[model samples]
Target: MTVWDRPEPPARPVPLDRERIVAAAVALADEGGLEAVSLRKVAARLEAGPMRLYGYIAVKEELLDLMVDEVYAEILPEERAGDWRAALGGLAHRTRRAALRHPWLADLLGGRPALGPNGLAVTEATLAALDGLADVDTVMRAVETVSAYFTGAIRREVAELRAERVSGLSKREWQRASGPHVTAMLATGRFPALARAVHDGADGDPEVSFTTGLDWVLDAVATRLTRASP
Candidate 1:
């Protein structure tokens, strides 16, 4: 009766593969977001009953883990082009795009649940992107710092996006939500600095803040790498 509705399976059992099952779940998550993904829903999408899915994916949590890794697989496992700065910058932007595309991906990936093959490959690519750093310690430190910045930035953007979707309000509206409380306090002029800050519209762009932070972090690493004698 519907476009996405699959035909009911025949009475006989249909063979199920774990990979195929996971793929279906991933597609469901991509289309409907995480909450719409469930054993029953995945089965329905695959044109089978809920009971049919468990033969491959034991539980919903397991299904989620698979779905999360599946998205991770989208990133290629190779060195990014150009020098370290451009390489790592590309890595950060690509990561943010991946998380935004999948929506549920940032939280699950950041939590570092078991790294499926795809997850390992992506991490390795990120590490390789740090080429030219002198020692193992420096390399590892750079990897962790860039990764922390990239993932943290992705998470914040995801939250902001969700807020924008639900409230139909831009970031300015979000700031305005605190406006009344801020205004009443300013009536007494007790906090001159705070008042001046608010009046100046000094909130600044979060996107630029993330980029600047990433650059500063890399700068510190470069400093350490340079200071250490070969």
Candidate 2:
């Protein structure tokens, strides 16, 4: 058959790009966690052959990096009219919320340097907040410290949430009555401080705990900035 005479070559599949591919992978991760995301699965979701994905992403790790940067777009914050503390704290809270929405994010947080556009924007905004407050080294150290704090805290919180889903118990419940073994251990008087805190400590809201800890860290940052100031 001639070129125009036979079905017009059946049309091309919908154009595939990195955005669509990353989106499909993110959707799969949202539904079934990170393990569910793979190049083949993403290609399947796009209704394209797996090999077709290579043009956009070279490997699964590259796709994962793109996925992380994509989520960083959600964590990006608007310009706030406040001090550095407000700026940094807002970024931390937004990041925590984003991780909660995309639980798989906890696994990837801090696993690699975020060098993509959105990720760099986040780092830029963070550094910009304290730009004039301290020397370059001090500022770098402050950012690293704050980033470390939130990264670890968010990971732990996500882990606890997963544990709760699996065990059908809240954190407070698990700590206060974590089976007979925990109860027996606590009763042994060798762990007086631990037992007292577990029994008497209130199960404060997680957000509140996160906020409080962030504030403490930010306060420390503020002190360092003050010291570094003229």
lDDT of 1 by residue, 1-230 (tens): 22112243334455566667888887887776788789998788777878977656666877787776677666553555666666667767677778878888876755653466676776666666665557777777776777788888888888898889889998888778978988999978899988888898557676688788888877886787677526
Which runs of model 1 end up more than 4 angstroms from their true locations?
A: 1-16, 77-79, 176-178, 190-193, 201-206
RMSD of each: 6.4, 6.9
Candidate 1 clashes between residue pairs 3 or more apart in a chain or in different chains: none
> Which ten residues in a row are the worst by lDDT in model 1?
1-10
Q: Show where candidate 2 strays beyond 4 Å.
A: 1-12, 172-179
Q: Write the per-residue lDDT of candidate 2 for residues 3-111, one digit (tens) a residue.
A: 1122312224767777778899999999889999998999889999888777667768888888999999998877752778877888899999999999999999877
Q: How many angstroms is residue 139 displaced in model 2 relative to the true structure, after the best TM-score fit?
A: 0.3
Pairs in steric clash, model 2: none
Error of 2 at 30 (Å): 0.9
